[model samples]
Target: MNQLKVELIVDNRVNRSTLSGNGIRNAVSLQPVLYVGGIPNNNHINLTGSGLNAYGFQGCLSSFIVDGRLLDYQRALVLN
Candidate 1:
């Protein structure tokens, strides 16, 4: 399998429920949901990004999520 590099830039204003990634928003669930062409294993999916002015509703996400599930990763970061 080949590797896929996904990039996201979420510039959010107004505190409403929405999921913004690479400039896409769901406007409902408020979680980032990325859809690829084929069904890829969650373990194979690698997520990396940054956020600011963010206070988590679930007390800050220590791990990235794929389809609303926590991902297994070596490290997690929150940059201001």
Candidate 2:
């Protein structure tokens, strides 16, 4: 299967309610959802980039979602 490398940046203080506890591991935890695609095996997805600022908090995030899902992710990443 073809694997894609995904990257993200998010506010650090934004409560990651969707992805907490065990869900934090091996998951590309997005705010409203978690996207898993392609082969659907436990593959490693790396997310790296600068941090974001909202209110008084700094946000940092990086991960992999399906191809089109980036639209929503980018919205959250920028307009926090």
Q: TM-score for all predictions?
A: 0.19, 0.16
Per-residue alpha-carbon lDDT of model 2 for 1-80, expressed as tens digits?
Answer: 22324443344343323223333344443545443333224644433221221123234336433455534566755865
Residue-pair clashes per prediction, in order, are 0, 4
RMSD for each of the candidates: 14.3, 14.0
C-alpha local distance difference test of each model: 0.33, 0.38
**Model 1 lDDT vs. the true structure?**
0.33
The candidate scoring highest on lDDT is 2
Candidate 1 Cα errors over 4 Å, as ranges: 1-16, 19-61, 75-80
Candidate 2's C-alpha runs over 4 A off are 12-80
